[model samples]
Target: MNNLTNVIKERLTKIGKDFNEKEYGFLNTDERLRTPVLITLGGSHAYGTNIETSDMDIRGISMNSADNILLGKDFEQVANEPTDTTIYSFDKMTSLLTNCNPNTIEILGVKPEHILYKSDIGEELIKNKDMFLSLRAVKSFGGYANAQLYRLQQKSLVALTPEQLNAHIVKTLNGMRDMLEMKHDMKGIQVHLKDGEIVVDINVNDYPAESIAGVLNVFNKTLNDYHKNSVRNEKAMNHGKISKHAMHLLRLYMMCEDILLKGEINTYREKEHDLLMDIRNGKYLGEDGRPNKEFFDIVKEYEVKVEYAKKHTYLPMEPDIEKINNFRKRMNLRMVEQITKRR
Candidate 1:
């Protein structure tokens, strides 16, 4: 572990009044902090993709006081800045877990070294992590991936300034290349690249001449836009955004694919370090701040894998709801017993 992460671990354990004063006014006293059910590192660190500049993110679950729950006092979660830590109440955590929330489910799969604290209740929760896995992961992971794709598209469109406009054009052309290769039969088409200029030629023998003309017209317009704006601004390139979104887009697909194929949640990306690190470092991104052809090919390959996994997965059409409910009842009963013992 690095020095900064070590320091973060120390500070997270010493939950002070400043951290709780605004978020948890009900916890005027230090009762809640005295015994948290679980605490673990999250985000890039937990996923094993941390760089020197990565922020420390911590997540945990704490039991609510009987009075707080019984009286219907609000204590759903607590978020503290500087460390970017958030601890959800046990009740809220369980509810989210049942829905197959990506954030909450990830807590169950954190590496042992990343676990700062874990009580018996927390241990039990981790042991029964499989209870939370189901077909629901498909929707959750897919939704997140779609959101990332939307953000990338939105970012590509809003180009007011000249620099931003040029960047947008570059990104659009890169996407066009990927779309053409993936969606269309490339046998009749040939792409030529020279001095940053791209030309496409279509064989009339393989494809209808009119159809080829329509495709070429669209490509020509895009090329025209790029030449008209012809100025490049080094600062306009959003390498960080490209790299971050690219990494996450691939990661989400990988996670969902694993869930469908093996019925397991693997949060750590140790096996994909080389590819992930390259993406994170912008190695796969073009000068336009968009992922290159190779990246799109990988995405296409994973899409096929996930489709196959969905059809062949051993998981049921839905989660075993009765088994999950039974587990929840037992955990709640244990919580009640603990409260009674305290009283």
Candidate 2:
């Protein structure tokens, strides 16, 4: 345990609370439920963007217990909600890391002092973190940034102009087939936009029932999301939300650009603290409580750079799934070994 972690534990313990308090006995103190392998600093502290009043966030990964594995029950995560602490099961963590998830990917690259605890398994996980980096970072990080921007824009991702809406429909229609059949059958479905109307031509045959069901499911979900995103948030116009979310919007873009351009992860924005803090502190917000022109102009510049990096980056289209699966199997076997030893 590090001094910072000890300080936190001591502080909490003194106040009639502990990290493994009654309700959270499953934390480090329990063997039947979960056991954390790595716990690191998260949120503003990890990003070097914290103020004096910033909340503490502790994030970690836990190995699946014997009961979880053998009982075939799902054990995804345990959280200390009040403290913003979360320990994800190893399997869930692997799933997220495999997709180059923006939030979890940063875990492997936090400054050393920020790492509160790490076991041998955690060390190995970190060593192979590079295996998780891929072209997916562009989409994952960019999508997250867009989500933040949506809050600031008071709009949903599905907010589209007349032409954009038609284009979206065309794209969705083009994918309405099974993964294998989509490639060969996409040519059969031709969609065209004439003046403001959509014209579609379907000349397909022998559509599998399963694929038809899959398309219906996907289309239903997509339509629901579009309906939901069309409504704007009333509170997004507030200054606090605008500025804070704008800061994150730019941060996400920066993080994505870094992964694409540098091929390394550095979560702490030490050099950009001034710029990020200024944005968060409302320096870039206008008198009307909206993000100012300067803010959007800055964001636009980053957007262009991110797009360029996305196109030119050397990263592969996907992570090495086979290698990642092998590593996960080894970890699971080790966990079972430890459990057997206790037995």
Candidate 3:
């Protein structure tokens, strides 16, 4: 463990809470908040993406019906922003997610990772992800996936680099490998990365690495040139969504680069990460939180590995059957919904 990780663990324990590595990594949902919540942490840092000198970000979620008497009148105005159809109270956040509102729900949708410091209801939420993942509920909140792709394309066109191009390609391939692994046995795929020529992994009774690498290289070059020109010629507002899979890989590459460069990340300085030049320049948010010195110290004492930034590559023998099906389902549903809504 590094200095920051140990500190975070200590802080959580002091506050009568505990978070495993995965839990800590994705930490900004309603599940982590305390009921009658007071925000002690908010933004990217709390979401497990922090770098250096982060300004400890925090926010409170509450019901609009209750004017948040606990946080006082001054905070009431800040808490007024609705995350969606329902209003979320955030004026005087301490260390909780006590508010239950439509706006809060919407915020939850955007903030994929969050950790609450205190709250009975929030703890209950962690126990039951299914409640929040209803297909109907998410679909009602607007097209989140579409929005993500649109933003990604804009960012990529403006600031892509050679490193980012490579990262994007490798990341996409790995995603395919993972999905296939989860749903099917490793088949005939063989893979190799460019430049390094390192075989990150190999699996195959059949198939050839040359074929896979050829296609990947072709796509990478095309996308690279496309983005480089788009960045120079395009205005930000005129951009639209790119391929969802491709966009995700683009963003993930940007983030991984941030992680590798930042080194240390904590759970209290999310806003600082956002304000960083790298982030503003279209880099991904990584290590955007404050340090928990004590917990960080303990992790180092134990010599635990916190793998926040290492790059990975994977080779698959066959394409993912499940992913193809899921993609079709999602695409079809999205198309129909968009048409119906327009009508």
Choose the strongest candidate by TM-score: 2
The residue pairs in collision within model 2 are: none
How would you encode candidate 1's per-residue C-alpha lDDT over 66-116 as one tens digit per residue?
666567553778776665878888878876776577778888887777776
Better of 1 and 3 by lDDT: 1
> With candidate 3 superimposed using the best TM-score fit, by how many Å does residue 12's alpha carbon deviate from the native?
7.8
Q: How does model 2 score by TM-score?
A: 0.74
| TM-scores of all candidate predictions against the true structure | 0.68, 0.74, 0.28
Clash pairs of candidate 1? none
**lDDT per prediction?**
0.67, 0.72, 0.34
lDDT of 1: 0.67
